[model samples]
Target: MLTKSSQSVATIKAEDASKNCILVFDPDKTHAGKLNAILDFLGYDLLLAHSREELAHQLKKYPGLLTIIITGDLSETEQQDIVNIVAREAEHILPVVLYSVPAKNEQPVSLRYPPSWVAVKYPIAHQEFSSALDRVHAHFAHQQTEKGQRPAHLFRSLIGRSPAMQHIRHEIEQVGPTDATVLILGESGTGKEVVARNLHYHSRRRGKAFVPVNCGAIPRDLLESELFGHEKGAFTGALTAREGRFSLASGGTLFLDEIGEMPMDMQVKLLRVLEERTFERVGGSKTIKADVRIVAATNCNLEQMVADGTFREDLFYRLEVFPINLPPLRERVEDLPLLIAQLNDRMEYEKHFSVRFSPDAVSILSGYSWPGNVRELANLIERLGIKFPNGLVEVNDLPMKYRSGTGDGVSHDSQLDFFAEAAAAVRSQPFAVKTKPTVAQILANGQDMKSYVSEVEKNLISQALEETDGVIAHAAKLLGLRRTTLTEKMRKYGLQRPREGRATG
Candidate 1:
């Protein structure tokens, strides 16, 4: 039994006892002293108590006692009460013995219980007590070993410990154990397939296959046959009967990627399959029962599609019985480091050359919005490994497009000219083909608008340069022009002379 406070009703000195041994009992002061001394002399360690109440409370604090020696003889009902407490409340397996002082006339009283414990009288052989204690310790050790050897497949594969990930993990935990339909919503390049895999692996259908089908990839005429299978000769090219994703995944999970892209007519067929758990192959008479689980994902606004009548509202609700929404990479920028580390590990395991991203490289990465999220990051890292194998990827090593903010490394001048030319095209469109010109237009009709446009560009460029502290790169950003374009314009307008005085442009 566990030790209670020092102010226990009856206390023992607690001398040299094996770590595996404990003694619990209720005894009068005189009897308690005698019992403690005898047990000490006999090499038996003891934990004492004033009553059954104290003993039961102590048991909660310590676990696994080899033997318990209950000291005085109580009534049969009282003895059974103590036994019940030990059987139900003990932390781990502990063999128990009821010890009583030698009786005046006949044999001492003994109580019986299940095989888990033992009952013995006092003045018993020392060897008998020690042997029973050893047995209790062995039982607990064996049980712990068995528990440690269970398989890893019992849990899902998605791994992250951050608070944001924890919330996502908890949501997955709640639904992964059930058979409910799942809907995953996120922007493109987020790992929707990974989440779907986690849901399938953690569910009761783990051992079965996970079939993923992209609805947008198939043409309208072929999509129905692709999803629902088809009988022989259903179409011109149909030479034999074929099983659709639903039938193929009958005992597992079917993940529909970009389900919002599925045609409206096909949506009706899908709803029927979900509602009835049965479907008919194209040109087939028999309706086949399907036991497949559904895991659908989309980056589109499904509610808006439903509202616009492009998607069936009932089908949308059925697919969205449970939803898991993923945050965009920009919102979870803190996760970038961990994600990069994980990606690096994967690259190494694939036998790719080792690489490292410079601190400045990471800083640049963090500043961007990651329009494509994790998938885009993964691709970037893989590309870096391939391009700069066995080397450090400094900020300068980054592709020029990414560093320049265009994502395609086009020359700064070319980007500016593209935008300026596009603006010019819109301005030059015929505004009035047959309308008569006003007197002011007749007077100025011969003047070129080109000079006026150049003057407007010059004034805006000078203001942007002043606002940016004369940093041409920053000025270009402010004016939505490339740095090179801004420099060229500054020269054309005689504004590029070295600034020796305060800017007055």
Candidate 2:
């Protein structure tokens, strides 16, 4: 539906998009349309700084901002605002601000650009500026890349109608175009890996490989070689040189699932690769460029793991740039019908047979708790298809556990009608009131880091114990801690329930 003015847009160098990204600030609305189309056609990462605040924010957010286009006959006030923001926040790293002009000699006046910035008349930039533009190849050489390819047939779209699913799709679409690291979080069978694949499918790296590595599945001793590859005779099993997930996923995406399961020493090496964007294979001195985008997923309580000294804090912050938390099926029961349809469709396509869930059967399934999440639902659908073939599944046909739900399945006590309204809540919002001090407040107060952390941990354990009525196992689960660990922390802090005392805790 988009019509290009000329093929000249395509004639530009293919790699220019990454290095020649532009930010347009056209307060007058004069040059937005033409430039918008040109940038789109040319595959440039175009962004708009509609307000002065946005100009500063975008500069710090996207290091790939190579060029800036500011339009309108700049009044003295507007020019000063632009100069102050761009100079302060943008770092003026090869800053080349092009001002839209009416004629060649007529300068867009009064905009006394900073000494570090190069201001040029637009629609006719100086020829020498092209050389300066060429230097932009290094713009994101140290930052990130957005080289992606989208192919339709390779993956299934996320299927759901819940608010949680809608938010997830929005996030995927927003960050999919850029090369930011994504961390998917959820319980087992909640489809963490599926989210990773969806991210890759929607990303610019769709044409590249989507290499997945389950850190927990691989032995700790071999995880390093599995990720960074190995040279011939690297170890006992290294009979020949082999490419690892990082090498295999070059110019693509490396999905590190169960990242929490990665050992501590290996975590150090992985951190180096991520920070340096270069890694040498095991037993090899040759350093290779890591052109792969990282997408990590883990069901483990990484925050709790970090608190317990099990996971790396720095590595946690690194991969957790943009986190996508998947809602478990029990929390989003309204999405069951849509998820069922998707799974049934898959079964029919693959096996040439299907089973349809009647309305009552769906209601029963919704009322029943799903401990295994979507993967459980998927397995159930496949089993039903095999049992009933092309037949309809009625309420009686469902498992006893589902049929045993509140009477007619949909009807329940007014106080406990979970199936009717559970999905309305966003997964990330905690039901309990959070009255803890923010990271900013803690940092600004200049408190001792160790003492502050211990006090906070003590407070959390106390709160959890209070909420669970001094039940140790229950409170431990609520705080995502091991029962033994929580008990030890309780002893360390001398946490005890009133009247019941330490023995109860």
Candidate 3:
């Protein structure tokens, strides 16, 4: 039991007791005592709940009054469940502080929010705890001014355990609190949207709306009006005065995904919005003040686009106030198992078959380069779940591409050599090695691009014919080129198929 101090460290004289109370939930009594001591020292009164059930009960009676401080060890799953529960039950304005202490000599970061509500490890000093509560209190006071509504969808506590994901989470934590416009750079399937959401949820304006617009998905003609709003009679299908995403998300965030695809003309207008924080609706003269944080994401290289003059340079700089680059899936292959487990749980919940990959299957997956990043891996796992309905996916249960030795990440020369050796050892075939120049070397040597490419193509075809006992189709597959393309290149290069004379040589 925590002994309360005689005098309050902080005081809020609320006529309604329910409107000004704090709730602290701790599974560990020791940590809970530390928190209580800090609150007592700060002159703030708090209600304590030792279990989830008890916390849920208090949340029901005084949904508006409660802000939460949760600490101690809990699993990732439990943390996420509580977040979902809080989102479901609490008043939109309520804030929750998730604090934790790591085990002795252990790092205390939780990957996903499920097992622990919102985690802060131990060794947190009294001032740190007090400052955290003060921030939360300020946020709730702002919520009260704004009508007891918090940005519900935006405050999601994203959870993941992979190192790549951990790095991303840290980046979000560092960047989210500020008003800086962030540019999230990642491949198509790398969950840029999730990062955007996390940024908005953790920002000062977290209680406001977070509107996400996919730039690539929307029609180019409509994107401008969609973002800036249109008047009642702006154009066809303009039924009434409509607010744009910028207006709807006023005092919050507007996430522009696939921003690389935005038109050059619109980019200029967007630049103005960022600069002036104001925009006029189509067919309307009134300049509305924009009060939204902008977070943009792109898979394309904006610098290249700037050099080409297809994208506005001014807009690029404005949008890139802060930038985060997500590592590709292949670069973070170590995270494959954890991602697979997450996918498995998600699929099971969706009534997709509960599937488990065998150790060999997992090994094969981890070894392969995920060109499509996390999205592709997720699709592959979901597919496996269905293909192996019984949940146990064996080595053979994988696709042929996965089973093949093509995932070795070997050089082209090594691959060709391996094939040549296998043919020579198994079938008494003679092997011929091709001397080829790399594209870079050819360019550096001042050879014409067309000629250089043709020379390389000829060498590959000649080598394929030499290695396959002049078998064109098999050699085509070995080189990962179509039979017709190989044949055409051979003719173009004036290289003949190995006939009787060539075979003898």
C-alpha local distance difference test of each model? 0.64, 0.67, 0.64
lDDT of 2: 0.67
- Total clashes in model 2, counting residue pairs 3 or more apart in sequence or in different chains: 4
> On a 0 to 1 TM-score scale, where does candidate 1 land against the true structure?
0.50
Q: Is 2 or 3 the stronger prediction by lDDT?
A: 2
**Residue pairs whose backbone atoms clash in candidate 2:** 148-204, 148-205, 149-204, 149-206
Q: lDDT tens digits, residues 300-349, model 1? A: 99999988989999999999999998776654544554566556545544
**Which tens-of-lDDT digit does each residue in 1-505 have in candidate 2?**
1112222333434333233356677654435544544343223446665567766766666554556767656677878888777767765355556565456777535556775566655553212333334333233232222334321111466766455798999999999888999999999999888888888878889999999999999999899999999999999979999998899999899999999999999999999988999999999999999999999999899999999999999999999999999987765665676677557655654565667665446656866557688888888888888888766677788877667753232222111233222211211222221353222233235443234446666887788888888889888777655577678778878988543754444
Model 2 segments more than 4 A misplaced: 1-154, 406-505
The prediction achieving the highest TM-score against the true structure is 2
Best-fitting candidate, measured by lDDT?
A: 2
Candidate 1 CA-lDDT value: 0.64
